[model samples]
Target: MALILLADVGSTWTKLTAVDSNGSIVGQASAPTTVGTDIMEGFNSALSEIRGQTGSKEYSIYACSSAAGGLGMIACGLVPELTGQAAKLAVLGAGAKVLQVYGYNLNEDDLKEIDDLRPDILLLAGGTDGGNKKILLENTQALADKVSPLPIVLAGNRNAIHQGSEILSRAGFSVEVTSNVMPELNRLDIEPAREAIRNLFMSHIVKAKGMETLSRRLAAPLIPTPAAVLAAGKLLAQEMGELLLVDIGGATTDVYSYGGIETPAGMVRKGIVPPWDMRTVEADIGMRYSLQSLVEQAGRENILAQAPHQEQWRQELDKILTYPNRLVSPGLEGLEIIIAQWAVRISVQRHAGSMERVYTPAGATDVLSGKDLRGMNTVIGVGGVMVNSPDPKGILTMDSKGLLPEKPRLMLDSKYIMAAAGLLAGSEPRVARRMLAESLAAL
Candidate 1:
């Protein structure tokens, strides 16, 4: 029998899971992640504690993801609207947040704003199919001048790759050039850029953060928290065939959707990859850290719109934001229900919007047309609030309202450890699949 150890190093918590040869979970554990501390130290301590309990000398595999340090990025564009949106999409796709965006008309103030952000990586893009090259080149030059030693990804016009690289190199800045995100006005090509961003993340961002010290200590490279989630999503998509998984965390809600293809029986499975038919939406609608974003998106009107009896919900939400650690008050049961409902709505809508953009061909009319999204086969719900609701009926509430598919299976990250399981699954597909099967069975 073989054993595997998995860990998901999140911004707020580190979740650990131990699985046996048959893919049954043996033990689960969690620990608070020391935000500013060396990630390796925290990871090692958690690993030690898990191993101590299991008394396992050797494990078959180990994997991890991190959200603590903040996955930062700078987005560049030719036109503020088209390429700009494309650039934003690329950053979001990579599971990182955009700290800044620079476009053709962006002035010195914009550049300064970018500098102030101190992003982990910069994604530069611009121009329509074969439009302006000078604009992209000039923006690249300006970016290079203001920020040196920062890794830059040029995902602009395909015709300008060489010229873009030359300008950045001459300025002594490291640059990686990829395919045009907006090759044509109507079509967006972002895979090449997404790949380049991940590569640069390994080469530049990790090292710059003093994470290199920890990298040498660990057996594998550390992954950004969102990337790990994305990796798990890709694996699930391949295995489950067009599935939607939503993980609501303390700081953000991550939605990963797979709309095509099942993993072949013989091929080895690993983390999510580009070109895989999938979409992700990360909303600030978290239970704690980013509750404000959820409130803003859900709005008092919308939240209260559904629950007329929850007049104090807004006050509770405000109070929760101020003191995140407090437990949900008994009187606010309806408010919690409303918040969960609203979060599900916003998160699912965002997920579906991205899927529609990617899967829906222009001018095509099908019953699943933007109107019939409810027909999607599977929707997997994760996170503490959804999993540990005092009322089991809450899960049913999501199902009834179409927030979760009626046929969906709800799996709680009971240990808050799916990320780690996901990372481990990347290397051991059979074990991952087995664990997933068992998880669903238990659910």
Candidate 2:
């Protein structure tokens, strides 16, 4: 029987799934991601194990990577609400983590911080098609003088693109110019920027990570793991309808929503209307790497209220904070669950749109801001915490703000095949859809 190999090389682990041509998941394995050396070392180690289970050597290999800490990016725009947010959305959609999003010109301190962060790409976006050009000009000049030759994606005002691109290119920075992210106020044109970032990831970031060696072995070009997940979410939404996917990871929690939204009867939407397909990454909230930040956001008192043994849990929390990767004992898994609960709570709250009362001349009118996921009837949970937890569904049912589906069906990505299925979605829709249905049905 013909076989296919799908893999996701994550920061901490390299997971692989083997599936027959019939779309049956045959075997799976993983190893520590050795991006410190050659990434292929970990991949080979995992492949060796999979070989023992499936005894397959000749299979079509498809892979994506979140290794080398994924793609880090800094976005500069003219205004925080308009251009800045547009830039951020474009970066997130392209599967890059926004290290920082700066509005107006880049100051000395901002440049220094950018140096420290050492992002893979710098997305310079601001103004509209023919709007303010001064900020883009100033930021480009500052970047040329202060920043290293990191790739810069210029998606700002049409009036500034030529000058900005010239400034950066002359400074030895590789520049890709695309249409403005915000062509007009409240009108986002981010797809071109997103495509530019993805192309840079393939051309530049992959080489920087020394993934070129492994890229040659894949059936197709490598894609960012988060992008794969987002693709999978979109594909699944096509068949299953509108849904919200919450992916909790070691360092961040990413939420993706698909399908059109309906505004409440009398409520008016304020600010930018989020895309029908949208993704928001909560960098501060996570179970492991960002545990400290998660605790700080959830508050110690709030977290302790859920703990049966507060003092004991404090000591465990300290250890998890320090090591971040330390394995949790069976007895202490409850703490992880509690942490996961908060992670889900805080993340979904941020992901879901909110409404507030605004007194108008006529009467009190409600204004809604952000994506309204209330119409969603499905919530899919991925990540180690949810997959390993005994009560994964229970964790998602705690809708603190009534923003989630009123009574939703909760599904867990137990095999963590979302990314893998995503890698196949573009080329093998039948296989991808079957994999998604099978995995979700397993729950």
Candidate 3:
């Protein structure tokens, strides 16, 4: 049968899925991602497993990758609330990890931190269309002086583009200019900057990585894993109604929400309104590699409260933290499930919007910031924990305290097809949507 092949190359694992011409899943397999060596080593290994199941046949292929730390970037802008946040959101929407966001002008400490982080790209955004240009130029000069030659996407004030471009270009840094992220107060124009960053990621960063050979074999440009997942979430949201997707992985937990930005009744909106389709990656909250930090953040007492054998579970957790990749007896799997619960809970808490009681001279009022995800229609859980859990619904359940969906249907990405389907979204929307609909089944 004619078939389409899709792959997701992540930091810990490379997941593969085979889909038939009729948008039906055929087979799936996973192997450790060997980005440090040849990424294809793991890819071919997993491909061998797929071939074993489906037989060797000519097939179309598409791939997305979050291997080798994904696209790391540092955002520089004038004000913390205005241009700075805009710049950060632009990169995040492009599926990049914001290493740090610096407001005002760069300083010696900021310059030192940039060098230490050594991000793949620098997003310099400041001022409005004709607002403050001093910091825009000052930050550019600072970047030009102390920073190494790296790709820079300048999406700052339109008036300062020429000067900023000259500053970086003269310093031997390649700079890509786009429209201002925040042209007017509370008005965000992030698409241009997002596109610029994605273009830079494809043209410069991905091409330089070990996956370059693999990208040459793909049907289209290899995208970041999160970007593909975000695209899949958007596509699914078209049919599923307002939704929230939480992907709990070993190193990070990413939360994506769609079409819930409307202001709730009896509440005043504050801060920059997030995009309808939004994503937040909590780096410190994860299943394996970040388990220690996750447990610490979730609090030992909280974990101990629900854990079966508190002291023994804590000891086992310590061992896992030291060697995150080490597999334990299946009996200890309960501990993982407990951690997954906290992972979902804590990650979503950070991702969701919040309400605060503010007193004004007029009277008391409720103010909402970020997307109001309360009453979201659907919540889908991705990643291995959700897929393998015996009780995914239990893990997905959020306490009444946070601003999560109220009584939303829960689903799981069982075949790990979200990112793979997203790789095919541009080429075959029907197949991508079908795969997602079938794979994301109710628990």
> After superposition, which runs of candidate 1 have C-alpha atoms over 4 Å from their true positions?
207-210, 217-219, 260-284, 301-315, 330-334, 354-374, 391-415, 441-443
| Model 1, span 1-443: residue lDDT tens | 54676766666666778888666788777777655766566666777887887888576545455554557887888766678877877887776776766667557888788777778888888886578788888887777687555778888887786788898888887888888888877356787887888787767665223356555544556666666666666677676666666776676676666652323233332222223344444547776777778888877677767654555666676788799887767767767766766676677776542112233455532222111234445666666676666542354235434223446554544444456556655666676666666554224
**Top candidate when judged by lDDT against the true structure:** 3
Whole-model alpha-carbon lDDT for candidate 3 = 0.86
- In terms of lDDT, the poorest run of 10 residues in model 1 is 364-373
Model 2 TM-score relative to the real fold:
0.94
Error in Å for residue 416 of model 2:
0.9
TM-scores, all candidates, are: 0.81, 0.94, 0.95
In model 3, what lDDT does residue 242 have? Answer: 93
Candidate 3 clash pair list: none
What lDDT does candidate 1 reach at residue 295?
A: 81
List candidate 3 segments past 4 Å from native.
207-210
List the global CA lDDT of all models: 0.65, 0.86, 0.86
Error of 1 at 50 (Å): 0.9
Candidate 2 local lDDT, 1-443, one digit each (tens): 65899989998899999998767898899999988888889989999999999988888999888887788898888889989998999999988888999998788999999988888998999888888999999999998999888999999999999999999999999999999988888777778998898888888876334478878878977888888999999898988889888898888999899853567889888777787778899999988888899999999788778878898888888888899879776698778888888898888888888788899899999888777777776889987778878878767766635456666688898777999999998899888888887888433
